[model samples]
Target: MAVTRTLEADVLRRQDPELADILLGELDRQSTTLQLNAAENFTSPAVLAALGSALANKYAEGYPGARYHGGCEIVDVAERLAVERAKALFGAEHANVQAHSGSSAVLAAYAALLRPGDTVLALGLPYGGHLTHGSPANFSGRWFDFVPYGVDAETGLIDYEQMRLLARTHRPKAIVCGSIAYPRHIDYAAFREAADEVGAYLIADAAHPIGLVAGKAAPNPVPYADVVCATTHKVLRGPRGGMVLCGAELAGQVDRAVFPFTQGGAQMHTIAAKAVAFGEAAAPEFGGYVRQVVANARVLAAALAAEGLAVTTGGTDTHLLTADPAPLGVDGRTARARLAAAGMVLDCCALPHADARGLRLGTAAVTTQGMGEEEMPRIASLMAGVLRDQVEGKQVREKVRELVTAFPPYPG
Candidate 1:
């Protein structure tokens, strides 16, 4: 559907022109640049409309039909649609659509399954794990005993045998299988086997690949994992929210953990938006879009490799690809800024088992904008020029604007 922002603009402009100007500037930025951020996407206008709807006024403090508030009848509809759609999309026995963010979902899931001080096994942050997994600064690391597993130094792949050994040695209460920057398919079965051997609750943090799992482009973790956590944004291209899915046996625990435990009330507007995005993902076309995302990622990785950048794991089987720009004599942070200055947006990320960071690029946002394999080489060339200091930033920015104009992120 075409995006019509006239009403949004008028209302915001009348109420607060200063904030309205910032919003419009962000829209312009998104429209003109190549958004290569791994965890960001262009949510549909329908999703945006739902987020800005009257549903936001409601304060539904409990599950549907069992709310603490009196006037939750309409908000219940939105929450129910979101819950049911999520369950159907992921084939989960139960779904909780109320966690505030991916970190919230992870916290709630951990709370439901493990106790404070209980040992939890996960990938190390430096090896592509999320902060919630084990970083000392995060609540998960502070509250629980977070033991880390890492990718092999040479292969840049998760060492399953090492993980299995750690699982048996530490015998953690929970084992997490997922990543923030790793660029290959996860062996969920292997994780499941390890978790089973250790009698640990297997939690699959599918925040990065939920859409790919939904589109059957990646492995579904539901069957192998005891609980799955994800953000509605990212590859799902929905509102900025989080969800948890699990079997019926753990439904009550998970639900209670989310409400009256981790959080008090659900954001009904965002839940409504999640319903719309879930519907969109369920449609037949989403699968094609997801496949193209992977195709474009592979091409982009190869193109970047051709530019003398080291693509981690050699290439990608999903929407994201990580590369160390160190070979080009540029640090990840500098490369990110240089690319942004040239109208390409990505992030600096730590490579597997390395102290030095690298660039993490993803094709989800560009794929949402209808870019395909044909556009990958051009994007890679532009990014290389910026990072390698081969082409002037202004010239690359102009080329980026030209390409973005042809694509028109949000058609009206």
Candidate 2:
């Protein structure tokens, strides 16, 4: 499972020198920079190997033991392993690992439960929700009537009373409880209670915190919600793939929705990689990794707050922290660029109910690189200096490279 760049480079350089150059350049970029993006992670070499395996050439159009093609005898094992590992890892009655992305998983969940005109209550994009949850431009918004729920402006936390009120008023067919940028833990119990009162199916999108849930650092959403959708690449530290977990009752419906309704042929290679990640996650070492992810996030938030940035909700209970850097007289976009120039990558996010923007920082990727609580304060200080225009980005870049060199991302 060791990554051999020479082997891949030799193959690519023979047919596509330009692409080989670009791929190697990206690997170098990742090795040298601090990847602080909440939605990103460094997948294992075993995963990379699985993604590049011969399974990629197979065209298995259906589920295991029910493939439409004849040459799926071996690929069936990969798919079955992925499904079983996913179910065991999350304690779900069933799991579908065919969805190509987290957005696709959400689409499949909606396809299984709601009609085109059915109403769905979900968190708003500006309030930490993903675009698939119901942005005006997405198919979810175009097909169904999506009612938005948001955090309180004063507390920066979800207002369950308001959510309950909205659910009672709208009578949505489904209610989604999740966030892409929110820092605090989601109240799945509260969401379930509101959904029950409205006779709605509660879907928990655990894309950002599935690893924490697996490691017992966050509450499990599978027991509280009817269906859970997540991407394997975030805190889970797997390849870029999506999964939908549901009860035995809804398993058949969800499977049909994903295979024929939403996506076409499944990526067997990615499924193989997902199985590897799920197995790794089930190990005790992964639990320690996720615990440190949360611990490091808390340290990073405190360090940023000490530098005068407004850490939203005071601090984080998960892998990410949302901070309003407007106090430093810089917009989120500008701050992101400044940080990137300093070799510390992060995303610009919109604050709750405000026209201004903020930063969403995560510790999952850094933790994957062997960074701990002690390293977070230095990272925060570097980011703060660049955002406040106190030090040159080029100067900070040098410090970042020095730190990154000490902990190689993919050490052989």
lDDT of each: 0.92, 0.92
Model 1, runs deviating above 4 Å: 1-9
Put down candidate 2 lDDT per residue, 204-257, tens digits, no spaces: 999999989988899999999999999999899999989999999999999999
Note the clash tally of each candidate.
Answer: 0, 0
List CA RMSD, all candidates.
1.2, 1.3
Clashing pairs in 1: none
Candidate 1 backbone overlaps, count: 0
Predicted structure 2: lDDT: 0.92
